[model samples]
Every structure is written in structure tokens, then in C-alpha cells.
Target chain A: MLKKILYSLTAVLILVSIYLVFFYAPIPVDPKSAGGDPENFKIFYFHLPIAISAYLAFAIVFVSSIMYLKTKKQEWDIVALSSAEVGVVFAFLTLATGSIWARSAWGAYWVTWDVRLNTSLVLFLIYISYLMVRQAVDEPEKRARLSAVFGIVGFLGVPLSFMSIRLWNKTTIHPVAELNYSTFSPLLTTLITNFAAFFLLMASLIIFRIGVEHLKEKGNEMKRKNSL
Target chain B: MKFLHIAWKDLKAEFRTKQMLNSMVMFSFLVIVIFSFAFGKESSIYISVIDRKIVDLLAPGMLWIAFTFAGMLGLSRSFAGEKEEGCLEGLKLCPVDRSDIYNGKVISNTVLMFLMEITTIPLFIVLFSYEIKNIPGLLLVVLLGTLGFIFVGTLLSALTVNTRTREILLPVILFPVLIPVILSAVTATGVLLAAGSIFEIAGELRILVIFDVIFFIVAQLVFEYTIED
Candidate 1:
């Protein structure tokens, strides 16, 4: 019953978010450029929400990873892996959309040593490498334990990289972290809805991914039984 | 004491075989040689007539790059010997806690990394035609940075020890966490080599110091979970 509610809500929220961000919300203007990012800044609505969702997914991974370590439960491991896989997808979208936005606003796709972008890039790399590490290990239990350790360690980069960027931003020539729209703007309304939509979407996707894993496990078990 | 015993056992084995140390030193030498032709003050290359200033700007980053990749070799092998021989199982049988085992690996690993640097640093000076005026400061930064490197490296080395892709997996797991370590090491080395103000170098050094302390404790506490069956 609850699953039905969640599925319907996710579908509605996603459609609403797309409508609001694409049609209802006003496009953001770049203060640096003439005529502003009237068209390009539109990606901000999608990029920002997905980025936040990615962070949320990783936080879930961290908590579930910790719980897995404490209890030695396979369920928690499944939760972490599911969250991470979803997180990696969302993270890639965020980076891709962000680059598009950067190209329009900054006139370049990448700027080296810019703390915020570099931090995001590094964060993306760390988790991708986490998935790689997971794939490299064969034993299920051992893989879970090792990947859990990595999940925890990789998430530490989120806060640490931010701090390093903020502190070390002084020496570098790159522009400071982006602050596109001011607070209390109408855009905030769309941003909030998009945030909610992405959260629901992430939750829904995690459930499906975990369902897929469970199905795979069941199939493996049936194969073993049939062999017997 | 048991932790020391594990470390001593590793050291004794290494002393006899010299397997990890020899490879690490040679790898650093090879990397430095390549780096020199690419960045050395006087070289015949497409990026020709590279100035002293450019080399100064680059030396810290290059030096640490060599240290980091070479250190990865040592860290990966530090556990390869244990996992390959099924020696970790024997160690597990002795009833020592995971913390002891972790510290044992970190200590032995740090010592071997230092031994590699003993040879690699001299080679770096000769190849780059560089002289270290602030030897003590550079040493301090290297020690703090290397500790942070080994702390994360040893943990991930053990984490990947049982994996099919252990060789490739160690650096994948390690280099990301070592960002602060490597960044600060480069920054501090640049400052010291360029004879910048103490105030200028202090921030980067502080970063290395903090990284070493936090990661050392974190690695010890968390390592047990990684090793569990």
C-alpha cells in the first residue's frame, strides 16, 4: 500500500518538478555577462536539485555503511550499494549539467583549481572509484565489508574538500564558489520543489535497485537448488 | 607490545628479502628520471628551454607525485606478502585485536616508505639539480604527509588484499583520501624550497599535521571492520 503511494507520489513530483523548472520558474541572469544566462541558467534548477540528491544518497550510503559494519548484516550492505549506484548516476548528471552551465556562464567548460568545481569533480571520482573497488572483489561478504569501509572514507571528502577549498581559495586565482541566485527569489520556490522531487525520485529508485538485487540473489539461490 | 611484535616480524622479513624496499626505491628512481627529462632546467625537449622559475613551481608537485606512486607500491606489497601466504590467518589465530594488526602494518609500512625516500630524495636532488636550504622543514612535511599516506594506504591495502583487482584497487582507494596530504605536501614543499615566509608555509604544514593525526586515529578505529570475515 505504501509502495503504491510512494510510486504515485514520485511520478507526480517528477512531472511537477520538470514543469515548474522548465516553464514556471524564471531563468537566472548572469551578473557577469551582458543579457545574462537567460537560457543557460535554466540548467541550474535541474543541476542543483540533482546535486543535492546525490549528496543525500551518499549520506545514506555512509549511514547504511556504518550500520552494516556494526551489525554485519547483508541488508545494510544492500542498502549502501543501492544508494551508491543511484548516487553515482545522479552525481554524473549533476556534473554534466553543471559543465553545460559553466560553459555558458564562464565561457569555458572546465577551470582548473577552482575549489568548488574541483571538489565536486574529486567527489565524483572518489565514488566512481568506490564502485570500481566493489566490482573488483568476488566474495559477497568480503566485498560488502571492504566497500563499506570505502564508502565511509569516501564521504569524508565531502566536508574535507569543501573546507580545503574554502581555506585554500585565497591563494588560487580561480573565482569563488558560485552563488547564482539570491535568497527569497521566486526561483527558490522551484528549487524547493525540485529538491523534493529529486528526493522522492531517489527514494523510489533505491527501492527498485534493491529489488533488482534481491531478485538476482533469489535467482542465484534457485540455480543452486536446481543443481542440487 | 604485540603490535610492535607484528611490526618487527614484518621488518625482519623485509630485511631478509628486501623485496618491498628494493622495488619502491627503483620505481621512485625511474619516475624521477622521467620527470627530469620532462621538467629539468636544462633539457632538450619540445617544452624547450624551461626556465628555473618553471622548475621551481613544479618541483614540489613532481617530488610528491613520485613519493605517492612509489609509496603505493610499498603499501600494496606490504599486505600482498601477508595475504598471499595466508599469514593474516595465522596472525588472526594469535588472538590480537584488529587495532594491533593495523598499527603493526602502519608502523612497518611507514618505516619502509622512509627507507625508499632515503634513496629517492638524494636522487631527486641530483636529477633536478636542486639544493634544499630548509632541510628540516622539508623533512617535517614529508614525515607528516607520509604518515597520512601510509595510514590510508595501509587501511585500503588490507581492504583490497582479498580482492581480485588488488593491484589496481589500492591506488584507486588510496589517492582520493590522500588529497589533502598530497596538496599540503606540495604547497609546503614549494614554500620551503622557494624560501617563503614561515607564516606562508605554516598553513599547509598544519594541514599535513592535522591530516596525519586524524587519519592515524581513524585508520586504527575503522581498520578492524575492514578485516573481518
Candidate 2:
């Protein structure tokens, strides 16, 4: 029942966010080019929230991974794996939406020199490789243990990777959006609403993914017993 | 003490065979030669006619690429060798903590990487006519960067050794985590090569040190899980 509520809530929030994003959010004037499309800025509402949600997903992976290592719980492994898979999807969405935003802002689909862009790229690659590590192992127990170790190691890199450009003192073309909380605006409302929507979506996806894994495990067990 | 014994055992075996060391050195040398040949046009004894500024720009990236690629070769072999005769099983059977095995591999891998690098740097200097402003700073950067690499690589080596596609997956998984190390090392090396003071590279050095320390400790803690049957 709670899962159904979560599912319905996520669906409603996502629809409301889409409406808010397309209709409610004020299109900002492009500061650089006077004639540039103001509509492109709308992608910001989706992009930043998705990126943050992806980070949240990986954070869950990190926590669950530690729990799996400590408690040796299969459920923690499920959470870690489910979160990682959803995180990778969200990471990919962040890149795609960010690319669309970049194409309009920078006149390129991709720019290599930007720190945030490259860091996101690296973060995406790291988790994809995490999934790859899972694929390369066949034994269930061994897979859980090995990927948990990688999940921990890989999460450690995320902060350093994001901080890399700043540490190197390189300039980034990516804009760091600062929210004005002093005055409540539609932009703020839209941004917060989108954040809620995307995070709930992530939660629903992970929960559903965990359920699938549970079913797969049961099927495997039944097969083993019947074979005997 | 047990870790030292494990390292010493690997070193003894390595020296007796000289197989991995020879291949690593040769591979790095070939990489440098190939890079210099591709980049330099007119050459004579002691100096190539390649623009000094261009060499400064290229040298750090070139040198580190050679080191990392060569390092990957050595790391992949580091654990794969144990898989051959169930040597890993025997190693795990020892009374020492599992992390000792991880430390031992880190030490041996670091030693082998340093040896390859020590030879490669001079060859690079002579080939590219590269001038070092601060050799000590460069060495520090190299040391910290190599530690970060080996710290993570050794753990992943053990982890991947258990997988079917052991060798191919190491670089795929290892390189993303290695971005900060490579970025800071190359930047610091570039700064040093261009005659900048070591203090100018303070940020990169700090990143390298922290990276080295974090991965070293983390890999030590998590390594036991990776090797478990």
C-alpha cells in the first residue's frame, strides 16, 4: 500500500513538475547573446534536480554498501545494487539534459574543458564500471562482496573528482546557479518542486528494481530446489 | 612485519625471474621513444630540435601516460600470477591479516613502478631535451601520484582477479578513480617542467597526498572483502 502511494505520488509530482517547468517557470534573458532563446533556460529546472538526485542515489549506494559490508545482509546488497543502477540512469539523464542546455548556451553539444561537465562524465563512467564489475562476477555472494568494495572505493572518488578542477584552479564554462531565497519566486518553487519530483522518481525506480531482484532470487532458488 | 615479509617474498620472486620488471621497463621505454619520435622532427645528440615550450607542454602528459600504461600492465599481472597455481589461496591461508597481503602488493607494485619511472624520466629528459626546474618537486609529485595509483590499482587487481575478464576490466574500472591522481600529477609536473616553483603546485600536491592517503587506507580496509571466496 505504501509502495502504491509512493508510485502514485511520484507520478503526480512528475506531471506537476512538467507543467511547472514548461508553463510556470519564468524564462530568463540570455545574458550573453541578446537574441538568444530564453526558453533554453527551462532545462535548468530538470537538469540541476536530476544531477542532485543522482548524487543522492550514489550516496545511498555508499551507505548501503557500508551496511552490506558490516552486516553481510543480502537486503543491503539489493539496496546498493538497485541504487547504483538508478543512479547510473539519473547520471545519464543529467548528462543528456545538461548537453541540451549546453548546446543552446555554449553553441556546442559537449565542451571538454568544463570541470562540472567532465566530472559528471567521470561520475557516470565510474558507476557504469561499478555495474560492469557486477556483470563480470557470477557467484552471488562473491558479486555482492566485490561490488560493495567497489561501491565504497568508487564513492570516495566522487568528491575528489568534482573538486578536481577547483583544486587545479581551472575556469569552467558551466554556470553555478545560486538560488535567491530572500524572495520566494516561481523559479524557486519550480526548482524545489522538480527536486521533490525527481527524488521521488528515483525512490520509486529503486524500490521497483529491488522488487525485481527479489523475484529473480526466488526464481533461482526454486530452480535449484527443483533440480535436486 | 608480516607485510614486509610478504613484500620481500614477492620482491625475491620478482628478482629471480626479472620477468615483470624487464617488461615494464621495456614497455615504458618504448612508449617514450614512440612519443618523442612522433613529436620531435630534427634531432641530434643531447637535444632535439622540438620547441622547448611544446616539449614542456607535452612532457608531463607523455611521461605519465607511459607510467600509467606500464603500471597497468604490471598491476594486471600482479594478481593474475597468483591465480595460476592457486598461490592466492595459499597466501590467504597465512595467519596474517588480509590487509597485509594488500600492503605487500602495494609496496611491490610501487617499487616496480618507481624503477620504471626512474629510468623513463632520464630517457625523457635526453630525448625531449626537457629541462627540470625543480627535480625534487617533480619527484614528490611522481611519488604521491604513483602511490595513489598503486593504492587503488592493487586493490582492484585483487578484486578483478576473481572475475572472468580480469585483465581488461582493471583499466576500465581503475582509470576513472585515477582521474584526480592523473590530473594533479600532470598539472604539477607541467608546472615544474615550465620552471614554476614547487609552491605553485601546492594545491595539486595536497590533492595527491590526500588521494594517496585516502585510497591507501580505504583499499586496505576493503581488500579483504575483495579476496574472499
Candidate 3:
């Protein structure tokens, strides 16, 4: 009951922080602009955090996979699945926001052969394959083990896919700048706060998903006992 | 000794059947031939407009494109044939190390891929009129790149061969995960074809070798778990 209350509180906080980002926080000026007064770049605050959050979700999948292999427990499998699902959601958001930003800045909606974009799409497909593989296999042990191996292999690609564009010297609209002290103003603070809220939201979702899996497991155990 | 026997058995079977090798090699040849007609004509245009190097530079990407697709076909069939024959279960029940099974599959897949590369390289040169001065370096890249593919492909093949949609799932699962290998291979190949100095291209080559080593170790370590019933 206490955990449920904490989850609810975190979910509410996430919504409130999102509201703050859209309405209360001052919009940032476009960094690429020259000479004019700063234009509202409020979307960047949301866009970047969501993207980073998605990558974090994938990292969770990777770690949980290792844990699952170590413990040979089903709980970690549940964690891995939930993270992949949530990671896919955030990854889609990243692509959508990225496309919107690209349109605003580059006057184009899409660019083929952009290595980063292509790899992200590939990552999404790979995760979808994970879910599909799980669904196709009837045996629980087989599903868990296969998905675990795939989760580890798929996460290994994350860094390589990200670096491929840079290595190939392909042009992408996404900015890759290091955050500095000067970049952290009032607007930046709100962005960081929003990021924290989203992170909390992700945690809450994973917890909820895990609860569902536990219930399913308990129900299966009871059914087996009753049959015997 | 026992592992080698199993591996040799697989190799002998592959040679006698020649199904996977023939399909892969044929597909690779068709791709190069089609590209020669479609893109080869435009090569001169690009050469006249850009530096003459563009044709050579694009050679690596073109070759990898063919190899990747053909390799996917080969990988999907790697374990499927065993599964179809009901031999995979017997192998799993064998007393030899699971890593040996992985190595055996990797070796056969590597051989099939190597043969495809051997057939395609000559065709690529003949069709593209590409100079063959750096034959040794290019062969080295092909060997390393093919190793990278076989390392990951063998694992993914095992993972997907039991699935309902094995054909579709292998590429979807394998390509994204092997981006590092593809990137490293393509870059190194491009550098070699462009006649870049060996020192200049060494970084990309090193990345390819490292990727091959890391994934090969990981796959071998994880194969037993993956094959568990």
C-alpha cells in the first residue's frame, strides 16, 4: 500500500513537472541563431531529456539482462521486458521530436542514410523482435533465455550505432554539445527538473509492470497446485 | 579432438549438399552484376563530376551491401537445416562443450562467407574495373569483416532458427546489433579501396578486430544458455 502511494505520488509529480516545462518555464532561445533576440526553444528542454531518458531505459535492459543471467530468476526477465517496452516508447518520442526539430531548423522532415537515425530505427525494430520472439515461443524457460541473450546483444549496439554517424562523418541535424556551467541557467534548471520527473515516471512504470508479472507468476503457481 | 570431428562433419555435410554456399554465392554474384549495370554506368558521371576516387570509395559500401544481405540468407539457413533434420537436439545432447558447437557453426558459416567473398571479389574488379594493386590489404579486410559477421551471425542464427518467422527475424535482430561490425568493415574497406595509407586506415581496422573479439567471446560464453531447453 505504501509503495502504491509512492508510485501515485511520483506519477503526479511527473505530470506537474511536465506542466511546468510547457507553461511556467521560460523558453530557451535557439542556440544556432545569430544577432536577433533569442527565440523560444522550449521544445529542446523536453526533447533532449526524453531522448536521454530513452537511452537510460535501454541501459536498464542491458543491466537487467546481466542480472537475469547471474540469478537465473524470472523477475529480472520481467524488468528487462518492461524496460525494452518503455525504451521503445521514449525512442519513438525522440524520433518524433527530432523530426519536428529538424523541420524547424533544416527545412526538411527526413534524411535517409543519416547513420544515427537509421540505427535508432534499427534498435527499435530489434526490440520489437525481442517481444515477437517471446510471444512466438511457448516455453517459459526458452523465452526468458533467448530474450535475455538478445537484450544483451542489442544493447551492445547502442554505442556503436551512436558513433557510426560521427565515424563516417555524416551530417545530422542533432546537436552534440557538452553541457557546461554557463548552459545551466533557470531554463536549464527546469529542464533538469523535468528530466528527473520523467526518470521517476519510468521507474514507476517499471514497478507497476513488475507487479503485474508477479501476479501472473502467483496465479500460475496456484493453478499448478490446484491441478496437482 | 571430438569437437574437431563434429566441426569436420558439418563441413563435409556442407560441401556435399552445397545448398547454403551455392545460394549465397549466386545471390552475391547477381547483386554485383545488377549493380554493375545500374550504378556502373553512372560511375563515369560521378568520376567526371567528383574526384575519380568516388567510384573506388563507393566500392566498399556496395560490396558490403551485397555481402550483408547474402550473409543474412546464409545465417538464416545455418541452423534451420539442422532444425529441419531434427539434428539440433542431438547436438545439444552431445557431451562436447557448447562452445565447440558454436565454433563449428562459426567455422562453416565463415567458410561459406569466405567462398562468396572469393567469387565476388574477382567479379567486383572485373565489373567495376577497379585496380587490384592492394589485393593483400583488401583480402585482409574481407577476412576480418567476414569473421565479424560469422561471429554474430552464428549466435543470431541459433537464436532465431526456432522461431515461427525465422526468415524475417534474423536480419531484424542481427543487423541492428551488428552495426559496429558493419560500420568498421565498410569504413576499412572504403579506406583500402581508396588506396589510403595503411597507417591512416589502421584505426578502423583495429575497431573491426576488437568488435570481432568482443562479440565472439560473448557469443561463445552465452551459447550454452541460449541453447538450453
| Tens-digit lDDT string for candidate 3 (A93-212) | 878876776666656667666666776676676677677767766777777888888888877766666665456656654556445547556666777788887787777877777888
Q: Quantify all predictions' global Cα lDDT against the true fold.
A: 0.82, 0.90, 0.78
Choose 1 or 3, whichever is better by TM-score.
1
Checking candidate 3 for backbone clashes, the offending pairs are: none
Q: After aligning candidate 2 to the native by TM-score, how far in Å is the CA of B194 from where it should be?
A: 1.2
Model 2's CAPRI class?
Answer: medium
TM-score of each: 0.92, 0.96, 0.90
Sort all candidates by DockQ, best to worst. Answer: 2, 1, 3
Best by DockQ: 2
* Candidate 3 chain A worst ten-residue window by lDDT: A33-42
Give the per-residue lDDT digits (tens) of candidate 1, residues B1-229: 7899999999999999898899999999999899888754452223444476688778889889989999998888888888878998888887788889999988999999988887898988877666778777778888888888988889889888878988888888778777777877888888887876567777777777777777777777789877777
* lDDT (tens digit, per residue) of candidate 3 on B96-136: 99988998888878878888889888988877766666878
State in Å the error of residue A27, model 1. Answer: 3.2
- Put down candidate 1 lDDT per residue, A1-228, tens digits, no spaces: 887799899899889988987888875454643123557766777887898899899999999988998898999999999999999999888889877777877777876766767777777888888899889988898889889988888887567656655556644333333545675367788888888888999999999899999999999999999999
The 10 consecutive residues of candidate 2 chain B with the worst lDDT sum are B42-51
